[model samples]
Target: MRFFWSTLSAIFVKDIVTELRSRQVLPTMIVLGMLIVWVLRMASEAILTSKAVMGPVALWISFLFSGLLVQERSFAAEQQHDCIYGLLLAPIDQGTIYLSKLLANTAMLCIFEIIIVPVVLVAFRLGPDTRWPALAGVLLLGNIGISSVGTLFSAVVRVSRARSSLLSVLVLVVLMPMMIPATFALLTVFGAVPETLQGTGALSFIGSFNAAVGYMIAFDAVFVVACWLLFGFAIKE
Candidate 1:
């Protein structure tokens, strides 16, 4: 148990330090994310009048697109000097490697969100009624779900010639189930609960919100465990 955690920490730290030194992955993600947000804002000027609607759309779009970079680069970083072979040869479970990469990717995505979310809220003028705690919970769950599936497929496509494109397709396809519910949940959080889910009683905002949160929690748990179990096979030579 100790060895597993230690190895995970070592790998996580190594990735973080290397990224900090290189200034590669995070910068690209942030710039692309900001650019997406900016373009969306510009495009929506004449069409969308609802800040509530546009804000979440822009935020998630930036996240989904920029996030691809994080996952794509997660394993590609090690490919430069055959460092991935070193990780594979290490005395640790492959699941540990997966967890470490998942953590690293999630951390980067969270940092991206920390910077992007506030700028989004201010830009969209979401107002003081925005639910900060609930929004934070949603982002956290979404990050874990994204990172879990992304890390697994990132490893799967690590050696592919078209890994960047392949990773985007795989991650987006697998993420649809989670992302749909998540988008609705964000809509609710941003004060635009879908008309179908609005009204009093069991199908109210609180109920729908709880349902979305529960689904994401289940999705994250299932994928993380499934990915951990399958990572060995996915990563093998």
Candidate 2:
């Protein structure tokens, strides 16, 4: 038990230290996040004002792609040196490796979220009446779901010919179904429509959507384990 925790901790720390020295993951996330935020905020201004209405969707879109950037960075670096194969040669379980990478990606996303969300709040002019906490939780949770699926898929795609193009196609296609909950949460956060017209059901819908994905966490765990088990077969080609 302690060994597992220690091993996980070591993996996480090593990834963090490597990234810090390179300063690769977080900076790119921040720059891309800022660019997305800037463009979206500018573009949306004519059509929207309420943060509750524009904020959630905008934030998710920004964060989602930013996360993809991190996913790419995480693997691309290791691939450059062929270090990924060395990790595979170690005695650790494949699932542990998946979890470690997932956690690292999640951590990077959270950091970027913290930095970018404030800009979103300011740019969108969110109101005091808005449900900030609920919005934040929804974004964070939905992102976890996206990142989990993304990390696994990214790993699979990175080894293919036309890796970058193939990865983009695969990820974008797979992401569509997952975007529904995130959309619901964003709509609820923006709350742009009048109460009498917007329907009170958005909150319930968002909550239920979040809960649904939250339930999928266990499924994600299992899925990643399966992916880990199969990864060796795929990579051996």
Maximum-TM-score candidate = 1
Q: Compose the digit string of candidate 2's lDDT tens values, residues 1-237.
A: 787777777787888889889897788779888888888777787776655666766777887788788877667666788988887787876667777777888887888888998888888776535576866666667667767766777677766667667666666676665565556645644565322223356344435544544544544556556666775554442
Q: For candidate 1, lDDT tens digit of each residue in 81-180?
A: 8999998898888889999999999999999999999888888888426478888889999999999999899888988999999999999999988887
C-alpha lDDT of all candidate models, in order: 0.86, 0.69
Give candidate 1 regions above 4 Å deviation.
128-130, 194-207
Error of 1 at 130 (Å): 5.9
Look at candidate 2 and give me any clashing residue pairs: 52-189, 52-190, 52-191, 53-190
Model 2 error, position 47 (Å): 3.9
Candidate 2 regions exceeding 4 Å error are: 48-51, 127-130, 193-237
